[model samples]
Target chain A: MMKPGTRLKSAVCDAEIMIIKIAESADLSCGGQLMAEAPERTEGDGDRMHGCLIGKRYVNAEETIEVLCVKSGDGSLYYEGQELMTKDTKKLPSSD
Target chain B: MNIALLLQMAAEACPDRCALTHEGRHYTFSELFAAAQRAAHHFLAAEVKFVALMDVSSPAVPIALMGAAMSGVPYAPINYRLSEAQLTPLLDRISPAYLITGSEIVAEDRSGWVVRSSEEFMSVVSEGEISDLAWHDDPSAVAVQLFTSGTTGEPKAALLRHEHLVSYILGSVEFMGADEAEAALVSVPPYHIAGISAVMSNIYACRHIVQLPNFDPQVWLTLCAEQSVTSAFVVPTMLSRIIETLQQGAMATEALSSIKSIAYGGGKMPVPVIEHALALLPQVNFTNAYGLTETSSTITLLDPDDHRAALEQSDGPIRARLGSVGRPLPAVEIEIRDEHGAVLPPLEAGEIYVRGPQVSGEYEGRSVLDEAGWFPTRDAGYVDDEGYLFLSGRADDVIVRGGENISPGEIEDLLHQHSAISDVAAVGVPSEEWGETIALAVVTAAGQSITEDGLREHIRNHLRSSRVPELIQFVNELPYNETGKLLRREVRAWFAAEAA
Candidate 1:
């Protein structure tokens, strides 16, 4: 989904993501397959590129498309074959 | 996405983790989630416009909060400390409501007000079977309505949408990042924004929450030890009292041995109090969170590293950072704007403006964000050359004398550095020569004495004559609200009466 706050599950792996920011019609893929809105899709093929971590955000180089990993799985998230970089968030002390 | 997404994720990932502990009753994540769903059904069945909690912190606070969010109504938490006259109109504003009380206030059948006692609320929340229900996912829907009491008219209802709160949690916290061993002690009242956000953020992080309905410093320390509370959020005054309890040997340092981090805010923290705290609890990581209800919770955080670095330095930028609220969070952008609305450069004092997804600068009917999307925070402050934010005081509280604008916080902070003064407040009194003159209220330490002229000399040594308080009134204590917010408006009213 293009809207912020929309979550998508990986078609290929168990990885789940909630969109923080994204461009319309962007080719967002994970584990070499396009992400889907829900379950009950064809099984994902190809190698399971394992790297995504729970609670980490992956963003494109332009910094426009961002997604937080709500569930981690064996998948390297990508935007048009270029791997999305895991944002290096300086873990500040929880103030709440 | 709805904040319900956070609870859903946590429940799905770790249902067995202890999510909440209140009065010795521990709830797993799944239990909290199920209770939230049941609460949602209760709200949906009641068909209320607002879900109001006229109570202090309890499991009901979170359940009602999430339930309101899931059911697409705003969760309005009213200040339980308000007088009857003050609270009546506020209560009327948010009705037709599901009013839950955790206090002695008797539940009455006001038109459309469905009153539920705290005990009733708890049982009702947890009694029903789980339902596979769908929640509203609209990002723009108002999630929370906090009634912020100003010195003027009635309290203003500040609204926070689902998007704003979710962004704050996602931006500031990692999902399921906490281990099973972690528990946070939250003592800020249920009505305070800190109390609301603390529950949401800790739930998202999968940290066990231990709510103290009433805050007693000894009780707090004892609970910290008993519950193994590794993290906590306290207002500035609470920390001082906690430190006093530790110092008095009423509670040993080992009682707080499990405390790994403590976050303090909601008022101007005196440098001396923080310094003393740091010296006493070297093992604890201290964070200074600075934000308003309008900003969702914290936009800038003085993290543990900043505290450790500042405490070790004698004098420098690092040392001065202890006086600052550190830098803005990575997702937040802060600016200082002059009276004319032009952006001021670093180190120039002006009004603080913030821009971020989490900033919900909206009241019930009006939005405060500028066209460019920056919300002008009424709090007066400046950013250092290195981007550290130093809060002078609230813009409304600034004392204007002659042509210069004076910050009362500056004078009060300087006075706090004096050993004799235990507490202080500076306000503006009407003057003929100048529009307003300074009036200081000083609370000296027990058995300590200081003359007006001596206090004036002490102020003059550190600041200009204009900055010195014109009238010094020694008092036993400064007037502070339950949340440690200094009632400067009341202090100012007292001086105005004297002038009259």
Candidate 2:
């Protein structure tokens, strides 16, 4: 089972994420393609859309699946072509 | 999932920005990354299983911390204050380690360790040819090991995995959120969990770091001005001393003009001390963080807005939050449960149970997490109707007298309100009449005195008769550890000698 801290790479574009969480048999995709655990195929230069940020977290609408983008990509992250929204951070004081 | 990714990301994002400042030197993010890379080579060359740091705040802290992560070894910071008899065995446990300390001491008991002074280690790592070795990416691997200061037993080795710390950083801190002019001053000692989290969070925020080697209230105020520090973390004891120094009005406001925010934790902050601080430094923002080493630093915080709101209202629910530690972080969930494992409602104090991705309540030999992934923190605290938390002393410190439970925090808070008392600690002592009787070690205010009967009369007026202490001693000061934790175990011993 895919768990938190598991890394996944996009087969279509230069998108990489670490799994914050995943649902049972949830469809995890990036750039409209299913991401893979191994780098079986190198990323290609695709047109950039809905730019994914390197340090941003993405979650589905129901918010069951979550991922943290480790590398900025040319294509946006999605769940079977449905775009996941960026999670807003609740800012707290910088306590050491 | 190595913590090295944090530094690498910062270096790549802003290579030329200032990352650290010590005695008189400033290192850019790129320079710090290079030093870490060099240090990784040292750990690899020596083939050490762990990188142990036994020193105070210095450049070597980051070097060893990041370097150890890059080399796939746990970064264990040992408490150097431990005596030779108590320290030798701990060093042996982390044998084949690269020990970095303030001064090189002869390890008359160990041979596998490579001991080097922090200065020498820094110089050596700077001179070495850079090794481009990649960091180990195992998320479950241990990132840090801290030894808890147990009064009666051996110190427990608490372990934090890479995932635990990364989750905390991701949940609470924003990446590159700090502005170019923003700098954070860190004064906690190396062995403290806050010390490690300070370095981690600052690197991710891309803020400049200024280190205070030794804690002197005057020196801290002077350095804040010289370095243009915007934020800082201080223990309760340190904050009280700084407040005392500021009361003298020895220097102009310009000496502390750069300070913007101050965060305090590591002990129960006396209400009077915090109230005085807020009144004096009206321009400064204050935050109270509460957590344990196993939780990878703070799990809950009282933000500045909450602090202001609490101060604005004197007697309402809003003002009550001043004593509260606020709520849990977004990623964490907290529940107060009784001894029978039944969930308690709001305003009921019980054992604090927490469950989250960042809670790694694992020791060297045993894991404290229950089957449901919940870790029971031995601390005693309760939540308000709105989810704000108020911490009492440790659950173990609760005193039972005549089959009634009494919290020392309630007694200490009332004592703090007394005009003649400056600091106080209420502890349980062995008693024949009752199971345990309350004892007070009170520190009188400057140029003030109060008789034991007068103090008891004051307590009896506000609280119940059971809350009044049977034994009271007007001492000059109470016992606190280096990190500002009140030594209750030692406080309990104070009355023991007199009774004997």
Q: Model 1: residues >4 Å from true position, as ranges?
A: A9-15, A26-39, A48-54, A72-85, B103-107, B151-153
lDDT of 2 by residue, B1-500 (tens): 77887887788778899999999899999888899999988888887889999988899999899999989899999876777788878887888899998644546456667888998899987776785685688889999998886753678899999999998999899988898899999999888999999999999999999999799999998999999999999999999889888888865557779889999888888878889999988999999999989888898899999999989987888887888888899989999998899999999999899899899999995899999999898888899998898898788989999889899999998988889898899999999999899999999999999999999999999999999999998888888889888888888899998688
lDDT of 1 by residue, B322-368 (tens): 89998999989999999999999998999999999999999997999
What are the per-residue Cα lDDT tens digits for candidate 1 across A29-83?
Answer: 7887888787555455456486587778898888878888878888779877778
- lDDT, each prediction: 0.87, 0.86
lDDT of model 1 at residue B493?
78
| DockQ of candidate 2 compared with the true complex | 0.57
Q: Candidate 2 chain B, which ten residues in sequence have the lowest lDDT sum?
A: B102-111
* Worst window of 10 by summed lDDT in candidate 1 chain B: B102-111
Deviation from native of the Cα of residue B449 in model 1, angstroms: 0.5
Position B310, candidate 2: lDDT: 89
